[model samples]
Target chain A: MVLLACGTAMAQLPIYNVGRAPTEAELHPSDGVVGSDGKELPPGRGTAKEGETIYAAKCAACHGKNGEGIYPWPRLVGGIGTLNTPIPVQTVGSYSPYATTIWDYIQRAMPPFPLEKNLTPDNIYALTALLLYWNGIIKEIDVMDKNSLPEVQMPNRHGFYPDPPQSTPNKDGTWQPYWNQAKPAAK
Target chain B: MNSKMSDRRGFLKGTAAMAGLAVGAIPFANGNALASVTPGEPNTSMGVTKLGVTPDEPNIQDLLYGGRSRYETTVRIPSVGWNGATGLRNLTPLQDSIGVITPSSYHYLVQHDMHITNIDPRQHTLMIYGMVDRPLVFTMEELKRLPSVSRIHFLECTGNSGLMHYKSMLHDQKLGRADLTVIQAMHGRVSTSEWTGVPLSLLLKGAGVQKQASWLVAEGADLCRHAKSFPLAKAMDDVIVAYGQNGEALRREQGYPLRLVVPGWQGVNNVKYVKRIKLVDKPYYLGRETSSYTNLKPNGKASWYESQVGPKSLITYPSDAHHLPERGLYEISGLAWSGRGAISRVEVSTDGGRTWKDAQLQQPVFRKAFTRFRLGWNWSGAETVIMSRCTNEYGDIQPTMLELAKLWGDQVTPHYTGEEIEHWWETAAIMEFLNNPILPWRVKPDGSVQDALYNTLYNTNGPSKNSYYSGGKI
Candidate 1:
């Protein structure tokens, strides 16, 4: 019933002392990478019978024909265990994680940008082995090459942890405040 | 399986002939361009340097470089997207763009990580408690000291008709506006500006509201932390707590510094990387407001927490892959928003819905953000149906998801509305659905096709339960 509204701190001084104020990763830089363990990443391997011939010719136009995502496109298997419920249906082994970072994010970017022209790293290793064999992970005709595709293993890779890890640093010691389109409204 | 698909079509034709004989010199889609030069040459180059253009470089060593940090240290994600099974993806420009607010090398990302890459904003945090009165924890520089305001609004993507409902119930109006991509339907995840911050009723009046708090939760950091809950009188009317948008700061894929906008609502009630914000008075079927944004008819019962996003209309300069050049007086611009307020007019319909005019509305039209309405028409180009029909300021007029799933029976999940409904998607049926039995006393009240395919009336977001309880003044 009241409103008087009010709403930063990015400090890193020392320039002989004239004017300095840019350094929270030079105003936001927390960008993502994930390695040190997943290592050099790309070599490759895939299956789901070469991912159902790479999802019937470049993902049946924008994810349909079973992978059932039609509106602005995105559904590759019945969302298993809807993430903590309340209208959630995010598909593919239900919320992804490392199959070598989903075959290096489908061989760097996907098919709808000036039309990426049917990605081939063996078509992102058969669409990440037919989306980890349609989220059942392996078998529909499993094959994936390249040293046995980093030994196939994926199940939401233990839900993920390193949320803020640059060896535990904050105070702008490796920036973090991203999820864009401004989302924190509702005190 | 038919000879391992004939030996995987002979190993994808020997790996597309050894990767087309190894890249054989780039140029696949239009390789180099200025559209075949001749628009009076600068012909091209013109790269390097921006910020309001023609020289404004406030210096980041003259705004970033080197082939721009190797296209900003590689992270691409595309491949015929919705291609990794849809939930928002697309953001590639390699090197950054450096402000006018957004310009992290062209902030064109749509998230739900289609295998997303690089978005690490310093250990993120957004968790304001519910029913309020004292749950503070700011950081993103105390969320920019708080108090900020700016609006341009246009978040679009109520799943933009997913690949044309397979060519129309409105029968694939070009596959229902071909999963729109005019930069993912007019600039991916829309952006306008000046958003400063602090005003979820001034951080719920600096944390203190507990009179049994009416629903407020917000959550999301991705990997499906996607949470939603709100209605403390729409977070004390006109909620914000933003953290800078157009004026700058807040761009790690849009939710930087801090993010929670809610303007008119929908983009899943504007929640993302919002650590937590609990206050519960009720309603939490979760998993996206209950079984995938609800809407499952042929009757078995289910239409839960629909969430607002009503007054629709979208034409965007003859979009549908523009090519209109002819058609004379043609201005017909687009964009009209209204979660439930502002937009008092916008009708158009070229000749498809049998006569309707009134366009021009640019001036300073504000309220729930985006409001740019134009439309002059003339086009002797035949094949008409142009479209646009918004009408808010409380009178409500955008329904026709077939008339709100017949007033509510087929359990209308994609919730909310104003009713004039033109093409934000409402063909309601085009074919391939006889799954019948959505029987609310076998739908027939005079109209047909089982009462226009299961309408049977359900309407409850209010108007009952003693006018949604007490229904009076707070």
Candidate 2:
């Protein structure tokens, strides 16, 4: 239901139209959120074999020689089944539920701050493919693009559960937790 | 007439003598009284320099832009190492904090990529689109022209005390040392501010939001384009597209031109430098929500999208690293807050939770904003532990460390019995996002106050493993 400005009183609220309608040129095609459906993925293609060289030159300094990770920086490979262990190593292979997230994270934020915008769409695709191959999810020759990246299923896809519903504060200055409320449908 | 004249002369002589004593206490460095003096010099008897002693004054150029007195030296320090890649997480000095409102300069900061984007307000615009009849683009001036409201609230990082928990737990198991202070070390990732902006509900209403919209994704204008998804219910409730903070344009470190003020929510969802808001039917499940911020449970399952901080309180004045000089009468003060609502009550304990007394809560406590509390105590200059716990209007009381460990199924110590595990199973279903636990401080006989948990783990439980203190220092 749309939350109306007027409550049950049905009073006419003043509409001070301050902002103007955005033009077609002002609206970008992508909102920058690449969901699990991969609807927002841009056009790009790369193979793991081509990504190895790019990974060695650009990513290996911080992610380590084979993605074992330098101290403090994140590891991008292995630890596929370590989520259930006492020391759950939450690498990309072990924790991420969607493959599109790998591309989304690389495109938005990677290789630290000063050089974040240096990577192109093709460079990001190659890095994502390299990390996936290092994690043994894809073969070295497998190609990754906007289409196939979302099709690749991650091992921990079914691991996460929705959080409990938030409590609503009442007029009496007390709150009631929505513990009995049903969880939202999974995306 | 002669007696009156003599009395006036005597009073003038007494005033001259008092002036001489004041001059003797702080010797001037040179003929110019405004010059700063170096201590321990030959002429300086008390080793102190007094300002405003003479009629000849310094220029007002220093007053053009106000600054704190040179005597005040408290500052925010980076929580992590000097490396820039880790995204310098500067922490506020909670020990020195005076009240609920944190100064914008002293506010805690966490830049994901350690890049502070310099945004020009005149050129910056906020775009609201997706599932709306009219997709609106609002310039900063246009937003300011709309009806605006100012609300005081807090923004806290989800990983605020995660490190403290790990270190304290490690110390519990006799693995590592845990020497920490209240500043930057224990509780510093949270800060309160009075944000001025138009209510997001008004913006969404102006756009005529569609019925199918269940969530809205807010994105920042940083180099990384940080983003997070919020439920539409929350967006329409109390969210504010804030432009002003603490009665002025935001500081550059605090997203300068624009940001989202999601009241009472986790700090990550309060996207800074916010530029875009897109309404959607389902959650975007962005990289932050997926790869990070998800709470990994001990049962091999991780809970996602958990927001809202629980009730928590911290004693600031007599906290860790503070020294009481021949303790007599002292007023213990601290801050308490909750995401659910305003703090209804706060109780302080001087004997390590054995006895408690109701603390006086400062009036006009707003919902979800920091509330200051104070209590009076007389210390006999002996060893004892002091702590505080608070309850919110929602009746949610802050838990103890052992209670929290039981809730998370965390083996705090090796002595967990079967009965304890059975009891934990009964209460495991409780929502456990906010890691609020009672933090105690131990007052030593030598008048030094230390973190009680750290002292118990390192000094009492076993021999000290390592003496290395791992936290940012001012």
Best by lDDT: 2
Name model 1 segments beyond 4 Å from true. Answer: A1-187, B1-139, B142-147, B150-257, B267-269, B274-291, B294-308, B311-338, B342-394, B397-402, B407-474
Per-residue lDDT of candidate 2, residues A1-187 (tens digit):
3455333112212366567666676565443667777877888788887788888878888779888877557777776776665445677777888888888888777766564357777777788888888888988888888889989999988878753323234455322222112121111
TM-score of each: 0.25, 0.81
> Candidate 1 - CAPRI tier?
incorrect
Measured with C-alpha atoms, the lDDT of residue B289 in candidate 1 is 40
Q: What is the C-alpha lDDT profile of model 1 across B42-142, one tens digit per residue?
A: 21245642321233234466356423421122222231322223545543221111112233434444565443323355555444554454454555555
Lowest lDDT sum, 10 consecutive residues, model 2 chain B, at B465-474
Regions more than 4 Å wrong, model 2: A1-14, A29-31, A163-187, B1-48, B51-61, B81-85, B164-180, B413-433, B454-474
Give DockQ per model, in order. Answer: 0.02, 0.26
Cα deviation of B198, candidate 1, in Å: 7.3
Q: Please state the error at residue B464 of candidate 1 in Å.
A: 18
Write candidate 2's Cα lDDT for B96-191 as tens digits. Answer: 677789999888888887677899999999989888877888889988988999999988877675533334233333532232344345578888
